[model samples]
Target: MSQLPKRIIKESQRLISDPVPGITAVPHEDNLRYFQVTIQGPKESPYQDGLFKLELYLPDDYPMVAPKVRFLTKIYHPNIDRLGRICLDVLKKNWSPALQIRTILLSIQALLSAPNPDDPLSNEVAEHWKRDEQDAIATAKEYTKLYATEQ
Candidate 1:
């Protein structure tokens, strides 16, 4: 018997009806567990005006474990690695069963606005940010312009 999780259906409906600002996520029709996502960079950050793509997947035991999320867009951020893995506490050890997809996406969006270099996924980017914030920000903006534009 094919059974769709009630929670998943509710989440999808809510996401479609009341989408978050600057973020769009819709589940795949073929596979409800997978979602294609797009997030607009925060205006207050160097990555502003950039469009980032991402993929989200919910495991069978979703609320028991955090969902898997990865960026399809290349971002020049200290907490995001070259492979697009985010080094965020909530995405990892801090995740709670109570957290929903909207909240998780919101946290990811917030991370773009406030990057913490002290604990980073890309050591090189963090070093550059610590050494010269202006230069790092310029580099980030350049990367955004180059990579985040429509192809």
Candidate 2:
């Protein structure tokens, strides 16, 4: 691979040294652009008490294009598909070059706190959420308990 970008290196260092609260991102030794991330579910949300894992990859054009982030741990959210693709504007159309990995991850965390069923990646889940929000929250909590618990 070519020399790693200075910005990526700086971002990686800062992620380690000044980690975000309830979040941890660590780069692979051989692949600095790939990160193993863990996020603590926000309190009062269905995902609360769960620790969700995710993979984040910065493409060559990173910052110019949004990073590719997907949940590694299973979660039941209207905006997150079965394959773990998230439906968030900042990760797509609303992305800006000025945004950093930390901010992106924070946005994902916020998504957990407030899921948008109206604009969803998982239609089935969205329908369920729309039909019965309480039941949907229960299912989300169940999935989080079953899949996101730390070993």
Candidate 3:
């Protein structure tokens, strides 16, 4: 692998030293561009009390192109598919070079807090959410309890 960019080095350092309140990102020893991340579910959300794991990877042309991010832990959200692909605009069309790893992860955390069924990655889940929001939230909570619990 080529030498890591100075920007990545600095971002990794800050992530470890002055981490986000409910998020933690640690790079792999062999590959600095790959990170193992964990996010605490936001309060009052269906996913509350859960801890979701995710993987984030910065490509060679990062900052110019958005970093690749996907949930590793199972979650029941309309905007997140069964394969864990998230339907967040910032990760796609709205991405900007100014966005950092921390900002991207924070956006994902916020997604968990406010799921958008209207623009969804998982159609089935979106339909479920649209049909009965309360039941969908209950299902989300059930999924969180079953999958996102600490081990």
- Alpha-carbon local distance difference test for all models: 0.93, 0.96, 0.96
Task: List TM-score per model, in order.
Answer: 0.96, 0.98, 0.98
- What is residue 138's positional error in candidate 1, in angstroms? 0.5
**Which ten residues in a row are the worst by lDDT in model 1?**
1-10
Whose TM-score is higher: candidate 1's or candidate 3's? 3
Which of candidates 1 and 2 is the stronger one according to TM-score?
2
Q: List the residue pairs that clash in candidate 1.
A: none
Q: Per-residue lDDT tens digits of candidate 1, residues 67-98?
A: 99999999999999999999989889999989
1 or 2: which has the higher lDDT? 2
What local lDDT score does residue 30 receive in model 3, on the 0 to 100 scale? Answer: 86
Off by over 4 Å in 2: none
* 121-150: candidate 3 lDDT, tens digit per residue: 999999999999999999999999999998
- Steric collisions counted per model: 0, 0, 0
User: Candidate 2, TM-score vs. the true structure?
Assistant: 0.98
